[model samples]
Target chain A: MIWLTWRQHRKQALFTLIALAVVAAVMVPTGLAMHHRYERSGLAACLADLGDAQMIRQSEAAVHCQALSHQFQQQYSDLAFVAILFVILPVFVGLFFGAPLVAREVEQGTHRLVWTQSVSRRRWALTKFGLVGGVTVVLAVLYAVGVSWWFGPLVTASSGRMGYLSFDVQGVAPVGYTLFAVALGVFAGTLWRKVLPAMGAALVGFAAVRLTVETLARPRYMSPKTLTFSPQSVLRPNPATGDWVYGQGVRDAAGHLVASGAQIGPCAPPGCGGVAAGSYNWQLYQPGSRFWEFQAIETGIFLALTVLLVALAIRRLRDIA
Target chain B: MTTNDQGAHTMELALETGALGKRYGRAWALRDCSLHLPAGRVAALVGPNGAGKTTLLHLAVGLLRPDAGQVRVFGRDPRDDTSVLAEIGFVAQDTPLYRDFTAVDLIRMGGKLNRRWDAPLARDRLASLGIPPDRPVGRLSGGQRAQVALALALAKRPRLLLLDEPIASLDPLARREFMQALMGAVAESGTTVLLSSHLLADLERACDYLIVLQTARVQLVGAVDDLLAQHRTLVGPRSTDTGTPRGVVSVVRARHTDRQSTLLVRRDDDAVIDPAWIEHDVTLEDLVLAYLAEADTRATRTAWEVTA
Candidate 1:
């Protein structure tokens, strides 16, 4: 069964490996260059000292670091698009490899040949799904590692890792996403039984699920922690820690949360003209320390959905005739 | 039960069905089709288009589930047991082969999927047919592709082979060649075969047992020679008025001209004949066509009665 799976899908597997190799070839040199620049410019030390009051007070050091950060950001800014492409990579896997896995066989009437063999339909489906899905996950993990390593310097210097774009493409999320997408493709293929239509439906279905999870489900996994500070403090989240700031607002002395960008005059007490004495602004955020927790939660969701879809696909095979 | 050459009593039927049926949405593709084909016979399932021939064959191979009843191959439900599946080989209606796979790849796939795959026989058959093993199946001609499908099915070395319209699309020469190779395989292996074809001439040439299906029902099932002997065409004057013969199974067809009446009847015995009537032997083709035509007229009459 393993040999049969390999023989049938070696083309897809080879192309995927070559594509990953190409990505590695392009990223390795560029990543090394970025690391060399980070070391030479001393931006690492500057970033490390960003929390020091004296470093911020030193205008010359601040200016130099800002210039270095700008250069690094400019050089690696294209990686943001690459991250977006990485986000769509699983959809491509679902569309091309996953969709055609069963749909093409059905459309060409070859399932009659394969399913009627000594291998039972359930076994055949399982072998194909397991083998292809396992390979997809491995490739996705490799891609995640490569992209994360290539963008490590940029992430440390400019954008912290907890942002939307970085959160998804790094760590174990991409593997989960790939698995979910492949399962979605198989389910769609089983339902549609036509290759192109199955691919289209899988693409649309994957996008909907991904977007719903990212926008609606992921944030509510844990109630965000809130921190209150005087209005004199910076209005933005702490840049040193890459916490995902959900929202910020001001609260009056009575502890009622006020709309953001509201007139502070109503709540400002005596001697609070320059900085509000009574009204304090609060930050609602998921902290960077919970990155692994979030990854585990999101990956679990995708994997559970993947298992459901695979089970559905297998069950549906019995009714195919 | 019958004793084989080894003196072992055997009651195993190659295929059997009881009230078997299948439906596609509101329409029944096959309905209440019960049949039995004993082992070691070349049986042909003859039907018109949409007459449920393919449905019956698919059911026997467990490619399809029956909606109403059961299909048993080799004395057990083919769908429920892996052992039953292992003993039966099937080539579906379209002769579907993976277009991208080379002949060798298909053989390799067979070897991987089947426990009793005969790799050497497959390779040798392709070689003897002058089919290049390395060429992708898509590049092969239709006839060659059909041959490859046959080779794959034969290489499984199953006790029963089910072919659904295996040669429907082939030219006459290719059809003869395919049947010849199939017959040769059957002779060597003593395999039971259930083949479906709409071409009566093909069935006449290759099949000893005949099953005629029409309108999703079994119209006739018997050995070819027995069916021919049981059905006789009687020609007489229109006024003879042989209302209904005794010991008749069914009046298959009746036509009356100005002064002559022709009737095809299924009878149990060699009854005494009317002196004025001439009895002629029925060919397999004529017998099948008569049954199909009779079935169609009966269906139409039933529809008319319902409307009335």
Candidate 2:
């Protein structure tokens, strides 16, 4: 079974390996160069001294910190945009490998050939799911590790790693995304029993699940903590620490709501001073310290989805004919 | 026949079914299909298109679960007792091999998939046929691909082999060659075979047992010789109104002209024929066509009856 699976998917495996190598080739050089710049600019101390009022006020080491940070962001911003392409890699893997895994056999009528052999349908499906699913997860883990390492200097230079796109590519979360995408593809393929339609479903279904999860479910995983500031400050957590500031708005002196974040601008039918006199700026954010917590939470959610989709696909195998 | 006594239930049947049925959504693809084929018979499942031949083969091989009745191979349910699966080799319609795989790769796949594969037999067959072992099956000629598929199935060394319209799309030469390769290997193994085709002639040369299906129902099933012996053709004057013979069971077909009547009828062994009637033997092709024609007329007449 292992050899058959390997023989069938050897081409896909080769391409996957090549893709991984290409990603590595791009990552290693850029990562080394970025790390070199970060060290040479002495921004490591600036990172450590973030959010400290005394260091900002008295430390001479922080004199060139602002200029160096701006320079780093300017130099590496293009590379960060290139990393966006990595996000779609899972979608392609899901479409090509997972969607066609079972559907192609049924489409080509090879299932009848194999199912009539010494192997049972359940065993055939199990072995395929085990090998392909296992290898995909393993590859995804390696990919996530590499991307995290490569994105290290970028994260340190900007808003840590807890921000939206940063959080997507870093840590164990991408592994969960990869698993979910592949499982979704397999489940769709099994249900549809056709390669092209299953691929379309996988792509559309994956996008729907990911978009809904990131937009609706992720922010609600833990309630946002509230912070109040005097009328002078912008009321967002300092971007230097990479805290995810969810919302910023004005509140009355008595803590009654006055205006939501963007509504405070361009005063309409009234002077802005009317509300500013009594309202204090309040912000909603998740602390940067919760990075791993969020990663664990998101990964756990996607992993659970992966397991559910796989189990459904396996159960559907009995009803193929 | 001197039977070897092993146990009380010593049936020699390789494939048997009891009123098996299947449906797709609301419409029946096959229904009321009953077959009892003894071991070592090369049976032909013959019918028109959409006559449920493929459905019956699929049901017997566990590719489809019967909606209504039982399908047993060697006295065991194939789906329930999947050990029976290893003994059944099936080549589905168009002989679907992985188009991207080489002939060698397919042989390797067969070896890995079946416990009783004859790997050397497969290799020898393909090599002797001058098939390029490393070329993808899709790139091969239709004849070569069909031969490769036959070799793969034959390599399994199965007790029961089911083939579904395997040579339907092939050219005449390719079709004959495919059958030759199949028969040569099958003769050595003595496998119980059920090969299906809508055209009777395609399977008539290879099959000894006949099962006729029309409109998702089995019209006739028996050994070729038995069916031949049970049916007869009679011609008599059209004006004669004498009662039918006692031993004749049913009228399979009938035609009348101004002066004479021709009747294709099924009968018991001893049917007393009127002296005015002339009796003749039925050819296999005529026998099959007569039965098929009878059903087509009845179906058309019934459709009109419903509207009327």
Candidate 3:
């Protein structure tokens, strides 16, 4: 069964490997050059510590360090653009590799041929999904690791790899995304029994769930920690260093919320809130130190969802006839 | 181990179904399709399109689960018993093979999937037929592809083989050759075969047992020689339209004109015929058509009674 699965999917595997190789060809040279320039261009000097935690505020060369950071950003802007395209790999995996996995067999009427063999339908379905899905995720993890390494110097030199811009490509999340996408494709394929429609459904479904997770569920994975301040004696506040600021609001003297985020207009009722009432400005953020925790949470959510889809696909396969 | 009075060695039942049924939404693909297929006999499942032939074969192979009843192959359910799957090889409708797989690839796949795969038998058979083992099946002609499918099934060395319309798409010469290869292989292994086909001539020569299905049910099933002997066509004056003729077990079909009537009847007893009538042996095709037409009319009569 294992050998047969390889024979069936070796073409798709080869194409993916070649695509990975091409991406490597592009990332390797630029990544090496970017590393060479990280220290030589003095972007490292802008950070207060090796952690890229805070800017060297008291130094006279702070202005010079900002200039170096801006220069490095401009020089590597092309690589940054490519780095953002990394998520599209999982989408392709969903559409091409996963969508057609069982769908093409049913469409071509070949399920009747193979299911009549000595293997039980359950064994055949599980083996195919297991092999194809296992390889797809392993390759995705390797790609994610490569991208993380390539982006290491750049992210650590900026915001310590905790920002949304670098979080998705640098951790175990890619494996989850790839796995979920493939399993979603398999489920769609089994449900629809046609390859093209399954691919379309998988793409739309993957995008919708990914967007919903990223925008709606992600910020609240853990409750945002809050920082509050009085308006009159506002000090240069450094909350958790390099924290992701989620939202900001103002509270009145009595601690009733008056305005929030970017929706604040001048207080209509003249003394309802603001500096006149000693209202404090409050900011919400996920501390940068919880980066690994966030990655594990997101990956676990996607993994649970992937397992559900795989189970549904297997159940659907029994009724295919 | 039970035997008839003759005490000859009795073959076991290779396949059996009891009140087997399958439905697709509102329509019944197969209804109460209980069957008994004894080992060591090649049976033909004769039915027109939409007559549930494929449904029966699919249920037998466990590709389909019965909605109302159960199917047992060698006294074990195909769906629950994976070991029974090794003993039942099937070639599905149109002989669906992986289009991109070469014969060698498929042969290798068969070797991996089946415990009793005869690799050299598959290879030698294809080689003897001048088939190139390395060419993709999609590139092969219809005849060549069907041959490859047969080879794959035969290599499994199954005790029973179920084929659904495997030769339906082949030309005359290819159809004959396909059956010849199938018969030759089955003869060597003494495998029980239940083949479903609309082409009566092909099945007539290859099969010894016959099962005719109509309206999603089995219309008639028996050994070929017995079926041929048990049915007869009688021609007489139209006056007999009052009811069925004497000694007929049942009226299969009746056609009447101004002065004459023709009737197909089933009878196991030897009875005297009136001098006014003449009897003739019914051909297999006529026997099938009579039962089919009779079933259609019976269905209409039942439907009309409810409305009336």
Candidate 4:
């Protein structure tokens, strides 16, 4: 069974490696260029003080190179390209790997032969799940390593901001999500017993779940907190309700201070006038906080959901007409 | 013809159905289809379009579940018995070979997937048929594909072979050749076979036992020679009298030609043919048709009786 599974997945496995190579081929040069630019721009030294850069130099060239590196960090923080790759890989996996896994057999009526063989339906399903699911995890991990390498210089540059939700998260989420999608594809193929419909259902279904997570779940982690304080040169109490208004300014209709004060939210939503406290605005948020925790929790949740979907798929295969 | 203990032991039947039935929603594909095929005999399931012959074969091979009753292959439930399945080879209708695999690949697949496969036999058969192993199964002509499918089935070295319209898509000459090869293989291996076919002539050539189906029911089933012996057609004038003789198993059809009465009847020895009518020997084909016609009349009469 394992050999059969390996034979079945060998093509997709090669395709994945080739695709990853292409992505790396393009991103590697861009990454190296950015690293050179940031080091030349002194941004490398600036961030290097916060992190590590074994290749640091203090010349004009190094400062400009460092600036390019910093710029790359700032510009690609969203990891938009990598995120799109991650978001889309699962659909392709489901279409190429999951849909054909069962639908072809059912359509061609070869499943009858398989079912009647010495292998039971449960064993067949288990073998497929173990083999394909193992491949998905391995592929996901490989993708993570490749993208992580491309983002290596920047992640080290950004210090901690690059860890939980930056390009790393976007790039790695696809791996996890594709695992989920493959499971979904199996379920759809087994239930529908056809390829096109199964592909559509798996793609649409996974996309919906991903979109929902991105919208409602992701923002909670991305939103920054703000805290405010006023100097003794202006510190005073509020006349109304006797609440101490530290910055000695009139409160606005929206309950904000009329002037500069502490603001604790993800970077004051454009046009809001305020100064946040507890660390200079220029300083990056401290890493290893609730942010990393959220990422760990979210990943665990997605992986669990993927397992559940795959279990349902296995059950469906056993009872398929 | 052996006396007591001197006789050879009779082998157990390879397949047995007890009132087996299958239905697709309101339509009964097969109903009360009971049969028994002992080891080392070739039985042909003969029926017209939509006669549930394929349904019966599917049930017996465990590819389908019966709506009622049971199917046993070699004394074990067809669907639940892995040991039985390991010994049964089936060539489904249309010969669903993998389109992507070469003939060699498919043959190798059979060897790898099946526990009892004979790879040497498969290769030798393909070589004999001039189907080079390297050619993709999809590239082969329909006749070649059928031969490949037959090789795969045979290479399993199965004790029982079940085929559903195995030669339905082949040309006439190819069909004959395939049948000949199949008969040769069966004769050499002594494998029991149950194949469904609409071609009565082909079935006549290959089958020693016959199971005829019509209108979702088994109309007649017995050894081909036995059925021919038991049934005869009588023709005279159209029976103006509605009453049928007591021993008449059935009146196959009624026709009026120039005031002469003709009746095709299945009867016991007690049902004497009228001296005015002519009694003729019935071929197996004639016997099958008479049974089908008799079934149709019975169905129509029952429907009217219920309505009345």
lDDT for B61 (candidate 4): 71
Evaluate residue A202 in candidate 3 and report its C-alpha lDDT on the 0 to 100 scale.
98
Candidate 4 lDDT over residue span A243-263, tens digit each = 111132333444445444432
Ranking by DockQ: 3, 1, 2, 4
**What's the lDDT for residue A207 in model 4?**
77
Quality of model 3 by C-alpha lDDT: 0.83
Give the DockQ of candidate 3.
Answer: 0.78
lDDT for each of the candidates?
Answer: 0.83, 0.82, 0.83, 0.69
iRMS values in order, in angstroms? 1.2, 1.4, 1.0, 2.4
TM-score of chain A of each: 0.87, 0.87, 0.85, 0.69
lDDT of 2 by residue, B173-283 (tens): 988988888888888889999999888988888888888888888888777887887888888778444456456777788788998888887876665765666888998
Candidate 1: how many backbone clashes? 0
TM-score of each: 0.92, 0.91, 0.91, 0.80
Model 1, residue B36: what's the lDDT? 81
Evaluate every candidate with DockQ and list the scores: 0.73, 0.68, 0.78, 0.37
Order of candidate numbers by lDDT, starting with the best = 1, 3, 2, 4
Tens-digit lDDT track of model 3 for B49-158: 89999999988898888999999898889884668888988898888898989999999999888888899999999999999888899999999999999899888889
TM-score of candidate 2 against the unseen true structure: 0.91
Higher-DockQ candidate among 1 and 2?
1
**Candidate 4 wrongly placed segments (more than 4 Å):** A6-10, A35-70, A73-79, A152-173, A217-288, A318-321, B1-11, B240-242, B252-258, B269-276, B293-308
